[model samples]
Target: MNIKGAIMRVFPEIPEFDEVDFSQYSTPYAAVLIAFFESGKSGLREFEEFVEKNGGTKADVGRFLISIFQYLLIRYRRYGDEKVEVPAFKVFLTLKGWLNENGFENDYTRLLHSFVGYLVDIAEKIAEKSDCELGLAYMKTAYLLTIEAEETFKEEYFSELKKTAQGMVAEIYRKCGINGGLPEKREKGC
Candidate 1:
């Protein structure tokens, strides 16, 4: 099936899929990720509009998160060279605050756990393909560090989180066989 068909199958109830102009994005997954990030940037008002347009509930948002992660997993598995962009810690804090204020904290927590588990499975697959145990370990460590950073952001521990997240990104870059350590500034589309 096509990308749009796959996305519709994954998220049949999201009306935003119908309204979103996917031509600007190279892939449907990219479109969804951009929408998600845009919603977070807009204090979730856009997300609320998406849900309302689709006649969905907060529970659907949780499902949407899972779908996004699942898409990431698929893309990574199919094209091992694809770099997964880890959002900034501030994005997590904003999303967490929005979930708390909007009464979806529990759902978000559950979905996060599921997402991490999926990452674990993906890491294992990647390891198997590359025949490198250390690579898998690094991938898993990066994922755990990311989760830790997100979890601790509410306590104003962003300095430490930023450091850890940078380390995680470096590890991911290494695992992907990208040479030349973290740049002074990450290039766009990296």
Candidate 2:
């Protein structure tokens, strides 16, 4: 195969946004996404496995996959040429790229197996570079936050979460392709 042909054929399957209704999701989705992203190296596998293991069974998985993509795309924008510079996510991106090169193998639901794999690869590289222990210590903390964030989304007050999360909320909003800047007119509140 020529280089262009090989590139096109390498991963025959590209995820289709077919019926993803992102607008239907509430604010907590963004909150949960921020938590997943904040977890960095410690939570990559947890999120990836959650998406992969539940592939095709749950409706939320598709949303979850796209949420992750948006998160990384924001990372791509935030860090630009340095998205892989983090000591945790380079491992994730590399491994994900490897998996894609191998084949676009997906269980049919989350369509995010590849994306998750890539995140893990980047995380792995970061861990190696930083020499941080990717162990239960951080895992427990990361998941605790994730679970809490998930719950906050299910509550009636879920819409308020984005305003309450401070930096995490802001990052999540940015990742979701929303350019949340200062309000047009300054409010009394800071």
Candidate 3:
């Protein structure tokens, strides 16, 4: 099965929304949504296992995810890349708190720590490269990739996935009201 199939199987009840309204749900729910969009199937599996092992329901998992998302967004807004290292440490502290509260085993906690780190890294990259807002870029990348992967698999059109991904990113930028023009790279000393 494709990534979309994997995601739907893992999160069958995810609500439909054109834009993510973080306020509509608890942090946990929002976190799961972010993870769902950002990390895809593997991220889903990691979250599901963490919850199951710790006797956590989906909401508990969502809360943990949201905490990470909130930390990253706050850091991004405040620092604007000036203090990258500090934000990473702060986010780690947040994840550690959740792991302690949930009584996750040492091994499991380490795995989640890494996963959270990965999610943050990807989000930061998206924010830096795209014209879309950080949150919207996160959502759109995941959404578009899943669709592209599914169609590619069905059509056996494997060669153009890279181009398709690029197109999706550009489309997302346009939708978000960014010019979506490729910035001309300056060549070495004119």
User: Arrange candidates by lDDT, highest first: which order?
Assistant: 1, 3, 2
Positional deviation of 132 in candidate 1, in angstroms? 26
On the 0 to 100 scale, the lDDT of residue 13 in model 2 is: 38
Query: Candidate 2, which ten residues in sequence have the lowest lDDT sum?
Result: 1-10
What ranking emerges by TM-score with the best candidate at the front?
Answer: 1, 3, 2
Query: How many times do residue backbones clash in model 1?
Result: 0
Q: Report the C-alpha displacement of residue 16, candidate 2, in angstroms.
A: 29
Expressed as tens digits, the lDDT of each residue in 86-134 for candidate 2 is 4223223333343444353242213232233333334333333432233
Q: Whose TM-score is higher: candidate 1's or candidate 3's? A: 1
Question: CA lDDT of 67 in candidate 3?
Answer: 54
With a 3 Å backbone cut-off (N, CA, C), the pairs that clash in candidate 3 are: 28-62, 28-63
After superposition, candidate 3 runs with Cα above 4 Å error: 1-42, 82-190
- Top-TM-score structure, candidate number: 1
- Pick the lDDT winner: 1
Per residue, candidate 1 scores C-alpha lDDT tens digits across 26-125 of 4423454355454442324555566656566765655554445444445444544233322112223334555667788775565444344444444444
lDDT of each: 0.46, 0.34, 0.44
lDDT of 3 by residue, 1-190 (tens): 1333333334333322112232322343444444444554444446667456556674566455445445445544554543333333334444445555566546334444334334334444555554467545553443343343444344333225434445555766666777645333234365
The candidate with the higher TM-score, 1 or 2, is 1
**Cα lDDT for residue 161, model 3?**
43
Total clashes in model 3, counting residue pairs 3 or more apart in sequence or in different chains: 2
